[model samples]
Target: MTPYPRWTLRTEHTGYTVRLSPDGPWAELDAWGPHGAEHGPSALDWSHRTHFITPADAAPAEYLPYGIRPFTGAELIAAGPDGERGSWWEFDGAQETGTGLRLAFTDGLLGLRTVLCYETVPGTDIVLRWTEFTASRELRLERLDSAAVTVPVTAGARLTYLTGQWSQEFQRTQLHLTRGTFTMGSIQGVPGHAYAPWLAVQDTTGEDAPAYGVALEWSGNWHITAEAEPGGAVRVRAGRVPHEGAVRLAPGERLTTPRLACAFSADGLDGLSRVWHRYERRLSGERLHRPRKVLYNSWEATGFGVEAAGQLELARAAAGIGAELFVVDDGWFTGRADDTGGLGDWHPDPAAFPDGFDRFVADVRALGLDFGLWVEPEAVSPGSRLHTEHPDWVYRVDGRPARLVRHQLLLDLGRTDVQDFVIATLDRLLDTYAIDYLKWDMNRPPTERGRPSAGPADLDAEHVAGYLRVLDHLRAAHPGVTVEGCAGGGGRVEHATIARTDVVWPSDNTAPLDRLAIQHGFLHAHAPHVMSSWVTDAPGVFDPRPRSLAFRFVNAMCGVLGIGADLRAWTPAQRAEAAGWIARYKEVRDVVHLGEARLLGTPADPTCGVQYDADGRTVVAALSTGRLDGAPLVPGRPARLRLRALDPAARYRDTASGTTYSGAHLLHYGLPFAWSADHDADLVVLTRE
Candidate 1:
């Protein structure tokens, strides 16, 4: 439209535009933001007198090879059989497909073709981008990133990403980049707890400014690197299967990178978060409409002491407390008395369930609760029969000793034989019993990741492919079963895993205060329906502050509520209180799960809460985190929280307190809260009247 070779892709609320440089054949991002963003002069125009860098280096390329982007990072890096590592590609053609657009480039010298693909999520402000590489001859690829995203900034950029160790996952971290590059990734087999495959970049100038976000839909090892180029532009490059060395692309073979979801928001990080949540809901498809049932998992309750009678008793108690699903966690399998043994053996332990596994499941189902089981299919105990029978199934260097974590060795999921065995194990279990839910767990990373039989293989990519294949099979073959993903808590929780599973365990540490902080950070990027939080009696691993059971239930209710406490130890009064909370959660879960979410305040504040608005109703789970003895910053000033996504003219009545207020008043003045030592949390529901 502007005399340049340009294309514009529009989603429901945003637009993304790419243009071929008028003087050259390379394509670059021209505009990205709210609709009509492409009308103005290009923000990425690099026409001013630039630094000593090459034109290709300074240009905001959509996807460039190593030779073109010599100084800065390149999205594609490959070597021919003759050991040449650079690619000189010229724009061959461009096409618009039914799903999205594609721009292709070809290097005649090397007989290689590169295609940059773009697709917008129909109902959300997200553009899915990736690249495909095909060579006439074999090429060894060192780095084939999903896409290279360039955000045009005025001066500097601020990066916000999630990072943490195992139990303390999803810790929101921020880094301001004036120059140079900042990188974070996972080298472990899975997308480990070290970092989530997501990044958000904002201009360092304003509080309420447009922000851009990118998330890689990869379950394997990956990296996201952001570089602040010399000309006030920030470029983010993300890819799958990092540090696995070169992947070989045979002649005429095509390699497609993982999809990198790119989004924009003029309403700052919070708005950017909602964009991701909507896209995820779209990714969930029809599954989003189904109710996320309140579940009781018998992990923290019974541990390795699982028995038929004890489980049935727990199921009875769970049903009484309004739980719709009951799950038997680890230690129910044959020879699995503790963490040391009995992995990779799917059969139930006769000692634990003397009658039969089916009888135990039937008894639990008789209590009006769906049945679920936990299994770590990718792990094998050294003493187990499966491991002894096939020692070669585990990952290890030919003559080297295998390292063990949690007393279990990693199975070579990359191998077809191993994948088949895993599929068979799961198929047998599901075929034999009435398993309405499955909690798939992976506890450790691979130690000696070597496949001697397959020369020059990308072991990481193979494993990832196998993992996804298995999940896809489960979805197609067992559509009725609900899958909950866990990897020693919150490990394999990228978009790839999230799309296949019904829910994800955010962390193993279910202590109320610690979990609140974790969930607070998690909600910044993920939707609440997939966040599976549990009410457990285990004390805080990080913070030892004793919170009431009400605090725990309220905190867990913010997501898919699950109870993991030993209900048999509870007094009748305690049980009655839990029943009330569970009943209350069921009534408002629709809004809580499918609504537009707003984080009122952070966990560091004296009072913090999450507000959900949907179906002409609002649900708020507010909590007081600070000490009770403290007075307000302004004495006698009650804590008030503002609500988001509300109709200003409508009148709403609180279901619990029977108080009515105009929506304008609720928005401007916020609802008031009374905090005390015993009553630290409140679940308030309001219906428009």
Candidate 2:
């Protein structure tokens, strides 16, 4: 297969040049001055044009939807060494429409300045940002700070169009409106509403395709700006604003809007955020909640069968290992002997231990480890007493029953009674249990659509409001306990969710190699407190050596550290190694977790993948995942590496290998080392001495 040409800027109008960089998937359209302007009788006529077909066999097939829309007319704008400036086209889409665009360039890359001038009727604009960039596609749209402004809106308008690949085949199109703060109300035939601004069009074929739409009709106005940076981050900001409707775009006339997209190879979330921060400073606030020290969870070792004795043993083990917290997961709840039972019953099961619940809590505290409990609060098994009593509490269609997962059904969070029950239950647990943390688990999605007897709006309000209310109640009732949100793992790990909770469970698939990719994807815009586990998984699971342990530990250091395996079963040597690494991690935890991180290299290269903290301390973990095979014990010289974010004047030492090197030598000459034939590796932690 031929490689796609990298986009660049050209002086000739007829010649097309596209530039693909971390900053943008930018394109330049330069034509000589004194060009003819295309005019039409009606605005609608000018707006009509053929839509581009997104290639079907796009690799990383996930990144599809690529296209361009030209304006109805072009005018002889101007010509100079800087570049040509003209109003080529205008568009008044769902949100604010653009009136004209000014184009200029330095070197060859075209910088397009879009002017937005349209009125929103009745409602207001709340959040607006130009978003263009995918994990795979080479597209770039940067936001220019000098030319951006946040304006008020006072109107309601709609922009509808067919987007996505299926739009042409199924005639399905995504719809958007700008009546207020942009929110997705509902899709064509979907019965539910969306709080976010975007919606996916699902129809494969039919007239209903165009019915899939989004709306900007929230209660308030939002400030919006889209900026492209030199790096790959496309900065989109939507600030709160008051309502106003001074400018309106009539039908057939196009208003210009600023939006861009870019593509890049696999740089994790840290790389993504760096690119964004380089251009926009609004996201630089200190994280709202700080994370705790390392923790150990009793899931793999004891499972759900753990009772008071097992719990106490685990707590002791945790304390011995210097783990800050001990979490007892799954089996402690009332009537829950295993995964399939007592899901909805929040009370502690009496049969699991003869002692009362308070005694168990006291025992855990006696071990000098903070206590945490797992609760799948949003679900209940059919046999659960709560399910038996309030059959109406679970979401269901007119007559169909929601299928069971792990023999459980998701509670209808939209119901006020359900919300009240959850709040009351959690409030009681915190007051009674002396708990320091709670793992909030949601294990299922919306499987059915049904309106409350009260109304649909109430249902919509409850979905989001219920979760927020739970957060509020948790904070109010148990000020000391941190709530970690988990959706059968990473499903609920988004910006909106992060605002309400502490850490996010990055993923359940915690194989060391896999986690490098997983945590990389998650950290782009998320805080490092996103939780990752050190557990044994296959491919390397059955290995008799510490290779698996080493792999898991390396991955866990990238995020919050929690052991998912049973420490009681670990050999003495393994335990010693684990404790040593945990202590080492604690030394640099604050610097990496709270500091500004820079990715010095990519994981694709063997000698790559170095990360630096805000204070200039660096942690470089290089592994030959493929090169480690049966071979002679020949050591290779380590490659000299350039440090990206370092204090040029600071002296440093390697914490692990006890090697001392100056910042200058480290930055200029890199490090020297050779890989052992046995796949020997190092977690070289550098700190100022």
Candidate 3:
């Protein structure tokens, strides 16, 4: 009898089954499309399991740790002070949970323990895995990886992933799997925009072929690796980079690795993305269903020229276009005329605001808008009085000049003083005023990362932990305030930090045409509501492509919409058009933020667009970078846009046209072209009647 029966786990339309041998272990597993099964693994179908393993290797023999059995990645790995490394692991037992299963492994001699976890949701193909390590005695843990799992794949699978630089993030790369290790990561003190913490392996049949993807839920210093064996087996490992200090654990203490989420999709990359979207909603975005306020920021309008009178005027214009939150970004603090100085001093610039935030906050509130402010708590400008008084606060090595980016040095959040300082500053501001939101910005990566003042330590982990600590204290003290995370335009975007903040400033480049591609790439792993996109008057800083105001509004409306335009400079017609768009967006905001989304085609594709469908409601934003030329598009007519996720038997109505049609016809044919002009686009909102 099989020691471990087929433990089958199924989501809405996907299934994964695994079995174990008493002497060997739980090794063989399969991820396939939706199917039913009996209670036990033996009672179900194990007939096709032999197809994946080689014919010769399929025959069962005596259990042995040899190459012939197959090289599956270890679910757990640990070491003890007694030098007991990888030799012995006794399988204690297993149990099942509502979502998934748990297994136990122990090293008797070293008194080391490991608990392996696997979790799943009812409607997602993602299987979550993480491990916990504990010891009865003090153990010097040298290596602990969040994920090391071997997946069965077709003979020739292709690897697809994201990699790029600042201003140009999430460039997709598709490559054939080779018989070697392919690894990527960042130890740059934070998750750099150069490489995202996600990857995938897909069968090469076509775009619709079965595929799998993996993601690490960490914001600081992460790495991912794909190792393809010569025999067509592949093992992927991902987690926090272990380049420096060993995670030393004391007796009776425990350490938990980050969560590694792996998902399977028979419908290909698009399916994989939707699975992640579901998983993201399950984990983060608590207030996501809450109406996201249409905010107006003072950064682009006034920059370092921020003053009470100017911001009050901007707030009126913002309220003119139905902005709910009016934010005073940068230049409100002591001596902060520009990025050159006055960072750590978290006080109102007396010259700029004769009376602190009181009168200004009242005036903005009187305009029927919530107020927000920009802050960089983890940095201190060298020319400021804060640095002159507390020079030891910034990150520095002994006797070396602190490396400066944007002419400011990063404060060592790892220090107790720094942590307390941040908490106190935020408490003071929140306790003092009617501030409703915060724009937390980190403009530079860590330079001289070592905090010499602190003793031997992993500064990266400490900095992040301390940063979160500050945010936590603030949240506990003031639950009313919301936060938007920005690391010089989406640099620190990851599951960990994202889980804590209310939103992410995806990019500083607000150019509508360029954002179509950037926002397209963003939806692959993150939810649309968390990505805060702004409609701007400025050209795309990277591509500099000129576009229309309607084009800009529709692009930004794809996510948590914001208007960063210099509203004071807009003509009356533009303001009226903008007001119309804002009101229209408000009507469908629920569907866009809390909806199930899919990319009709990729961002890189010429005719790519985005679709959101929720509970029989659908919205399609069709984008045209150039004219949708050469396709069967009728000139001067609306482009034919299709809708998904409608009941087949039901009739649907286009709210704009008041015309009803069968769901089948809409899916088969589509709506007609309604383009304003070249490089402009359209949004269609439809629902079942």
Candidate 4:
């Protein structure tokens, strides 16, 4: 067997020195202070300590300092100038088996620990898994494991932590450690914040390391994936609660998390692709249908007093506009005319839709579009039938309604009956109507209920389980239907949520100007297909910028395009322009929807630029967001344009001006263009003869 190298650590003034051993499975970590001197050996003690530390303590010491602190049951074990803290802590590596290493570190001041594991299954090429961080004083456990190969790096790597803005030169250098091939990238520290920023580093061949994208949760849990281009990437997700920090640890506190990291060369990129392929295959095998681009809604169009005829008219309009699916946003179901009534009652309002939902679906389908309905599933109006029937489902405190937001109460999804009732209601609706889409909305956050179930653990688990069950049941019964997740719009945009739903309402506020920034932020980690909506707020909703409707269309084209305005009131010209843009979008929908996206200029940069290219064609968009002195001197000034993800050998012709440019010139010099004020323009490059 080829001997796997292990790392040796030496504490120094600069940072910790880590060396790899030619043979063995053990690694050493040494820490030093300002001046070069052996600060101490990284130690862990399961006997005296109350928690489990990875790379377990060598010599059972009465005093364990600066490494992963120990957790005894729900309490943390502390031993410092102070004595005997919590109890029942145990570190067991043998509990789970896989390929990877785990590290636990604590500096009397802060605690940091992580477990790295990799797993390979037969059908799936690689599966990287991990746990998300949650708000808890106790160490809640979750596991992230993946099936992938570990890439070996021959060159050394450096891990640096910077404070303040990322563009800034220096704030405070926390750790500058040298190790074999791998180093931590960005580690940030804020004085009072519980979670500090950190990055794991690995060496690439060139100056620009292949971008390792990161997805971070508000609760401090994060996942990192290596960008493997045309082929997908390898993802490293967190598993356990090894990185949680205690507010005040008098000279001693420990935290730990299960973490996994991998490094593979371009050769492994193919393997990674196969992994994603297998994942998709399994998903398909499970009959999980991919969600279609859906047209959705807001009550702004049909209004709160929409009757059967009004809804049917709107549905027909949507069908005429090439909308594949139509959703009855709100006011379709309920005895009340406005948002004030009928939330929990999953029945159609007889007054508003006198003909019944079955007929509405039939009318929508007859126009050649799929039918969809909206529901807040998680909330109940006080006057609703469901609330009157099962008042216990509403989360309350001290026999009073717990109000987090407006006149709504959270349904206790933690209860089996609640979950069953929701499932049955949705199932019956799908059976009754030819519904192809569901807009699942959660308007308020979880609050008031100290405990929804009998136990705290059960309540917490049920909260997560409830969502999963709802999604699972929906996918199982309505395999052909798509689900759109909207938590007051965009608030619930997370990886876990994305895995379950097809599209996310980027924001309820889809004003064009607001969309530019919001969409930019959303695309940081999410795919464009997930963000949906188009040209909203006619006569301008927020800012009275009577900008070209084409501008709004083009902006919304970046994602799934859907009109939020009342089409019935649109002028002939407005409708014509929308139809043209929609037609153009349909022509190149696949490329833009699934293509690689690159932000050419920084959000703060004067020249805001973005490019999207896939297959053989490319679209370059530039906006002169900042003030430009005057018209260009030579029709167009030399713009420092940087192109991304393009076929260097392909010849191209610009669709706008019928101009021709070589791929080389386009990449090197960029397409020269000028704009005035907030003027934005786009150039489409098509394959040439």
Q: Candidate 4, TM-score vs. the true structure?
A: 0.68
User: RMSD in Å for candidate 2, one decimal?
Assistant: 15.7
List, residue by residue over 1-46, the lDDT tens digit for candidate 4: 2243222221111222222212212222222112242334322111
**Where does the lowest 10-residue lDDT sum fall in candidate 2?**
57-66
How far residue 100's Cα lies from its native spot in candidate 1, in Å, is 0.9
Q: Model 1, range 322-408, lDDT digits (tens) per residue?
A: 999999999999989989999988899998899999999999998899999999999999999999999989888887877889999
What tens digits encode model 2's per-residue C-alpha lDDT throughout 211-265? 1111221111222222221211112233222111111222233222222211111
**Local error of candidate 4 at 662, Å?**
0.7
TM-score of 1: 0.98
Task: Return the lDDT, model 2, position 48.
Answer: 19
After TM-score superposition, the amount by which residue 365's alpha carbon in candidate 3 deviates from its true location, in angstroms, is: 1.0
TM-scores for all predictions: 0.98, 0.62, 0.89, 0.68
Name the runs in model 2 displaced over 4 angstroms. 1-271, 275-291, 452-461, 535-546, 607-610, 621-624, 629-635, 639-642, 647-651, 656-658, 662-664, 677-681
Give the winner by lDDT: 2 or 3: 3
Instruction: Rank candidates by TM-score, best first.
Output: 1, 3, 4, 2
Q: List the residue pairs that clash in candidate 1.
A: none
Cα deviation of 352, candidate 4, in Å: 1.3
